[model samples]
Target: MGKYTQDAQQLLRLIGGKENIAAVSHCVTRMRFVLNDPSKADVEAIEAMKVVKGSFTQAGQFQVIIGNAVADFYNDFVKVAGVEGVSKDAVKQAAKKNQNVLQKVIAALAEIFAPLIPAIMAAFVLVYLERFFRKISPQVISSVVVPFCSLVLAVMAAHFIVGPIGWKIGSAISSVVYAGITGSFKVVFGAIFGFVYAPLVITGLHHMSNAIDLQLIADYGGTMLWPMIALSNIAQGSAVMGMIILQKKNVAAQEVNVPAGISCYLGVTEPAIFGVNLKYGFPFICGMIGSAISAVVCVMTSTTANAVGVGGIPGILSIQPKYMGSFAICMVIAFVIPMTLTFIVGKKKLSMADRVGAGDSADTVDVSAEAGSISATENTETTELNGDGANTLRAFLTGKVIPLKEVNDGVFSEGVMGDGLAILPENDTLYAPCDGEVTVLMDESRHACGLTLENGMEILLHIGIDTVEMQGDGFEYLVSLNQKVKQGTPLVRFDREKIRTAGHPDVTVCIVTEEGNAKDFEFVTDIHAEAGKTEIVLFN
Candidate 1:
C-alpha cells in the first residue's frame, strides 16, 4: 500500500469505492471521510494497509489515520476518487456543528456577529477617516460627514454587533460565576475554577476571569479567584519541571521549561500554558488536579490578595502575615502534588522535535520547484515518482542543470518551445534521459540530439548555446537517428573549452518538443542536478 495508486485503489475498494464517499478532507494525520454508509467500510483491511496507521469512527465520520505521509496518500485518494476536498479547518468547523443546546446558543451568538464583521471593520475605518478630516475643520467638525459616517457606524456596530450580545453573555456568565464563588459553595467553585483555569489560559481567555477577580477586590475587598490563579500557576510550573525531569535529554522540552517556569512564577502563564503544559495533555491535567486541591485549601482558610498582579510569589508578598501560613501551604501543595502526579502519570519521554511540535509541518517541501518553465535563475527539468516502488523513470544520468537565464539564444532561453534542464558540460559528455528511441540526431554538428522517452516525453539536448553556428567543429555525436538508447548511455562528447573559445557559452539546454510538460518537472536550477543520482521531482 506504499504505492499511492495501490493505496488509493485499495482504500476506495475497501470503503465501497467512490460511490460511498460522501465527503472527504485530510488533516496532518487522517483522511476524514463523511461516508454515505460507513458500515460498508472494511475497517480491518484499512488498518492492515501498509501506509495506513489506523482507522476510526469519529465526530460522525469515518476517519482513516495515516502518519507523516498522509499528504501523499490524500493526493492519490483524490486523484483516484476525483472528489473535491475541504480544508482541515473546515473539517474542524464541521465537527463543531454537533453541539449541545447551550453550546449552540453561544455559537449562535458568535455566528450572528460573524456576518457583521465587515461592518465592524468599516466602523474602525470610519473613525480613522473622521480623525483625519477633523483637523481640516475646527468649526464644521460638529456638523461634519466624519461624525455622521464614522461615529454613527461605530455606535451602530457597538450597539447591534458587540455591546448587546457580548455584554449579555458576559453578564450571564458573571452572574452565575459570582453567585457560585460568593455563596456557600465557594469551595466547590474555587476547586472547579482552579482545575479549569490553566486550560483556559491555553485559549488565551483567562483574561476574562481577571475582570472577575478585579470586581471581587472592588466589591468584597478580596477574591476567591486570586487563590486559584496562584495555585494554578504554581502547579503548572511544577508540572513543567516534572516533565523536564522525566525527559531530561529532550532539548525542546528543556528549552521551554526555564522560560515557561519564569513566566508561570511571574504570574504570566501564557508561555507555560502554550509552550509546555498544554502541549502535553496529561501534564496539564496533573497540574489542574493539584491546583484544584490547593484552591480548596485556600478557600477553606479564607486566603486573599489585597492587590491585582500575577498571583504567585508576587501576590503572596501582598498578603498579610496572618494568612502567610495558609499561602505557604497552598504554594507547597500546588507545587508538590503536580510534580508528583506529572512524574508518575504524564507522557513517556519525547524527542526534542516532538516536544516543540516541529515534526508537523503544514506546508512541507514535498513538491518540486515549479520552474521547468522558469527556475528563477535557470531552467530545471524534473520527473516525479509516485512512490509505487515500480518507478517508470529513474535518473538518466547525474549532472546539474544550469538556469535558462544563462542561455544566450532567445528561443531556447525564453523557453518558447518548452521547459527542460540546462547542463553546463563538465566532461563534455551526454547521456540519454530515459529509455528512448533516438528519433533525430545532428550527427555532423554534434550540437544537439533528440529522443522520445518510453513515456513519450520528448527530449532535445542542445550541447551549447549557439553551438549550431560552429557547424561541426569541436563537436562529436556518438548515436545515429533511429538508434535505441538506454538512459545514462553516453550519446555525445564535445570539447567544452573549444565551444567556450569559439565565443559560445558552454550551457547545454534540454527542452521538451512535444508539449509544455516541463512544468510537471521540478525546476531545481539552483542545486546541482546529478544524472543517475539526484531525484529532482516525484509524481504520477
Candidate 2:
C-alpha cells in the first residue's frame, strides 16, 4: 500500500466518496475538488485528518491544504476512490457547472478583478493618512475632529469634486475611442488603437474602455472595440512566449516569463507588460506591431463582441457566432506574428543579461565627490592596472563574482552609471571593501552606499536590483553617513530572504563611480571570494 493510502481512504470517505466528486486536482500545496453534491462532504472530518492542514471553499472548488505533500495525497485519494485525477483546468471547468447564475457571474468577475488588487491597494494610503491626522490632533478632540475632517476631506476630494472631473474626462476619451472603432475609417483607426492600447493600460487609461463597451452594448447591441483589446492581450502574451524561448537557459527569467505569459493569454496582461516586456523594451513593441496587424483584420471582418469576456484566445466565446471564423484568423495573427518578431528581435538585440529582465534605464544613479551628492562623470576611461603597483579592494560579500555586463540591470550592466563588478552574494551583510569615509548613504531606501577610499577612489556598493522599492524594510545600517571606517568594517546588514520575497535579486554590485586620481583599475571576477578578505578589484 502507498504511504498515504489509509489517510487518503479516510479523506475520500469524508468527502462523500468518488460518487460525489465531479473532478479532483492538486496544486503545489492543496487538493482541489469539484463535487457533484458538495453538501455530502464533511468539512470538519476532512480538516481533522492527519494529512490535512486546513480546508476552504472558493469559487466553486473545495480546497484542502496538505502543505508540501498534496500531490502524493491526491494520488492516493484518487486510487482509493477508484477514480482518475484531472488537471487544474479541468477541475475549474467542472466546478463552474455546480454554480448558479449569480455564483457564476461573481466567480467570473472575481477572476477578472483578481489581477487588479495591487493597483486597488493604493486606496490604503488614505487609511494611513487618517492615522497620521489622529496622532497629531489634541487628545480631547482627536476622535471627533480627526474622523470628521478625514471623512469630509475624503468625501469632498473623491466623491464631490475629483470623481466628477475624472468621470467626465474618462467619458470624453471613451467617446472618442467608441467613435474611432465604429467610424468610416475604422480599420485604419483600429490599427492605431490596437498598437497603443497596451501603453494605455500602463497609464491606467484603459479603465475608460469598460464605460465605452457597456455604452456600445446598450446602443448597438455589441462593441467591436473589445475584440481588438482581446487580440492585443494575446499579442502581448505571444511576445512573452518568444522571450521565454530566447531566455530558456535563464532560470530567473523563466520564473517570471512563463507565468506572466500564461496570465496574459488568460486576459490579464499586467504581469507580462510590467514584469518582462516593458522592462526589456523590444518585446513590448513587437507585441504592439502584432496587435496592430490583428486589429486591422478584426475591423476588416467587422468582428464584434456581445460583451467584454475573457480578453484572450478564450475570448472567441464572446464573439458573435457568425464572426467567429474571421476572429479565429485574427487570433492566429495575434499569436504568430508577435512571437515570431519577438524571437527574431530578441535574438539579435537582447544579450544574456537583457533576457534576465534587466532594470529600467531610468535606474541610473550619478555619484560625485561631494558628500551626499551623487553624480557620475560621462567621460570616464578604463585602463589596466599592474598588480605590483595596485591598491587592492577586499571583497564586500562572499559570492561568485561576475562582470558588470552580466548583471541583470541595464544601468549597471551597460555601464551607464559607471563600470562595476557584481556578485551573486552568499550572505546578507555588506562589509567595507577598503578603509574609506562614507560619502553617500541613501536615506530612504538604504539599498546603496558610497565611500571615498583613503586613496580617493570613490566606490558605490549597491545591495540588489530594484531593492529601493523595499524602502529600508529589510536593511539595517551598521555605519552612519560620512563615518570613517576601516577595511572589513560591517557596513550594512540586510535580510536576503526579505529581498527575495519582495521579488528582487540579491546581487551586490561594487562600482567605481569616480576614479579619483587613480589612472587605472583591474577587476578580479568569476571566482567565489570570501568577504573582507579576498581581493576582488585593484586600483592604481
Best by lDDT: 2
Residue 257, candidate 1: alpha-carbon lDDT: 64
Among all candidates shown, the one with the greatest TM-score: 2
In order, candidate lDDTs are: 0.63, 0.76
Q: Backbone collision count in every prediction?
A: 18, 4
Question: Candidate 2 residues 1-540, lDDT tens each?
Answer: 998999988988898888898988988667889998899989867754645655667558887766556778887888899988889878878988777787687656544433322222333435665887898999999989887877677666666555656556545655676677767888889999899999877544576566667656755788888999999999999999999888753444665677778878888776677667876789999999999999999998889999889888889999999999999999999999999999999867863233332232345322212224323323222221222223878888899999998985767787754677988999888888877887676655668877776565677788998888897799877777667777777778899999999998899888786576776778999999888778898767
lDDT of 1 by residue, 1-540 (tens): 345977888899999888887678986456888777777999867755655644656445577766446788888888888888887556546655444465455544544343333344555656776776665656745566657766776677676775556455545655676677767998897888888887665433565566656555655676657766877888988887788766553333455566667667777564565546765567788899999999888888888777556566677876656787898999999989998998877434432123221100111011011111111212122232222212233333345656665665665665544565576655666666666776555433556666666554555666766666677798766666566766566666688778889897777676655431333565556566666445443324
TM-score of 1: 0.37
Tell me the lDDT of model 1 at 56: 58
